[model samples]
Target: VKKIISILQAARSKTLQQWKELDCSITIVANEAKDNVRYLYTLDKYFGPLAHASPVMMEHIPSLMNTVFMIYCTSPYYNTSEHMTSLFLKITNQMINTCKTYLCEG
Candidate 1:
């Protein structure tokens, strides 16, 4: 899990670097690998900053949540893509609401 968080932090940094260089003209569609072992804390660490830097993060909120959900969904203990996607949306909506709250408060 520690290693997974480190990798995700790296990926998040890469995404920010790409966003800076590319100016987000292109959509970065990521692929899912089987048995992904990423950690949620790593994602949480990056989400706030990434969203702060890029307003478009709000647009792809579903994809972001899906990425995290898929990590858990791919586990051997419970392989559930449908439930993962559904939960992803639920979480995505909460994230969006949080973002909206922050935007309004600021």
Candidate 2:
């Protein structure tokens, strides 16, 4: 879990730096981040059901929930396009649902 968080944090920081250096629009940055997340989700073998069921991961549920809520609440500020806004909301909802499922079922 710590390694996952560290990797994600590093990716996020790199993304932000690249966004600034390239002077890309917020929508582009958001889309890139979303794509990266989608790619990560595809790696279910690394974070599948058994991983979620681990005691260490289960203990972090509250922290994960808080992070998800923060992301959902702050997404609008980063969304500049109508399509991106809708997509962001959809993704956020999915994340929240996943977190809820893990917390409740684990």
Candidate 3:
């Protein structure tokens, strides 16, 4: 969860930086936007701080990927790709049934 949060924060930061480079005050060439001023303020409010934290979040992807791979391997039959499709379906069904049983019992 922490890794995921970091990744999202980094992405938000990068997006903020790219947005900041634009001239928000420029008038639209094709259509005169009625809320151009409001839009500029909104853009500043949205992307300003997120740009700073982007790098820290991006640095965590490798560990996060490893964790996901580990979880995906939790299925006993995940070792081989030959039966991967069938194995995935079976695993999903088992998970669903387990959840249903637990729900009923609780």
Candidate 4:
């Protein structure tokens, strides 16, 4: 679990770095792995616990949430995939609930 958390944090940092370095045109490269709803489920299941248990993990939540929202809003997946769309909605709702719980407690 600790290993998974470390990897997730690293991935988030790398993504934010890439977002900062990208050019203005904003070209969308379609990656099947990233577009998969199952992957989102995996992320939620793995990271959700860490977020709940560790303050350090919770600290990255806002940035990670923003990055995810921006990606989904801008990606082609936003328009397509009815099933995955529902999954994304559920994931977002779960994320919101988690954030609320943490924020209120903190």
Query: Which number leads on TM-score?
Result: 1
lDDT of 4 by residue, 1-106 (tens): 3454456567776455444434222333335445655335434534655446345665665755664565556555543567446756775676677767777887
* Residue-wise C-alpha lDDT for candidate 1, range 37-77, written one tens digit per residue: 23444356546644463466566666565766666655553
lDDT value, residue 61 of candidate 2: 47
Error of 2 at 40 (Å): 9.8
Candidate closer to the true structure by lDDT (higher is better), 1 or 4? 4
Off by over 4 Å in 1: 1-42, 50-56, 59-66, 69-73, 81-86
Model 3 lDDT tens row, 1-106: 3454456567776555334433332434213344333323332432322233343433443544454355346534333465445544553554455556555665
Q: Number of clashing residue pairs in every model?
A: 0, 0, 3, 0
The per-residue C-alpha lDDT of model 4 at residue 12 equals 79
- Can you give the TM-score per candidate against the true fold? 0.33, 0.28, 0.25, 0.33
True-structure lDDT of candidate 3: 0.43
Query: TM-score order of candidates, best first?
Result: 1, 4, 2, 3
Lowest-scoring 10 consecutive residues by lDDT in candidate 2?
A: 42-51
In the predicted model 1, the residue pairs found to clash are: none
Among all candidates shown, the one with the greatest lDDT = 4
| Cα lDDT tens digits for candidate 2, 1-106 | 3454456567776455544545446557778788547543433442343244345544554654454444445554432465446654664565566667777986
Q: Which scores higher on TM-score, 1 or 2?
A: 1
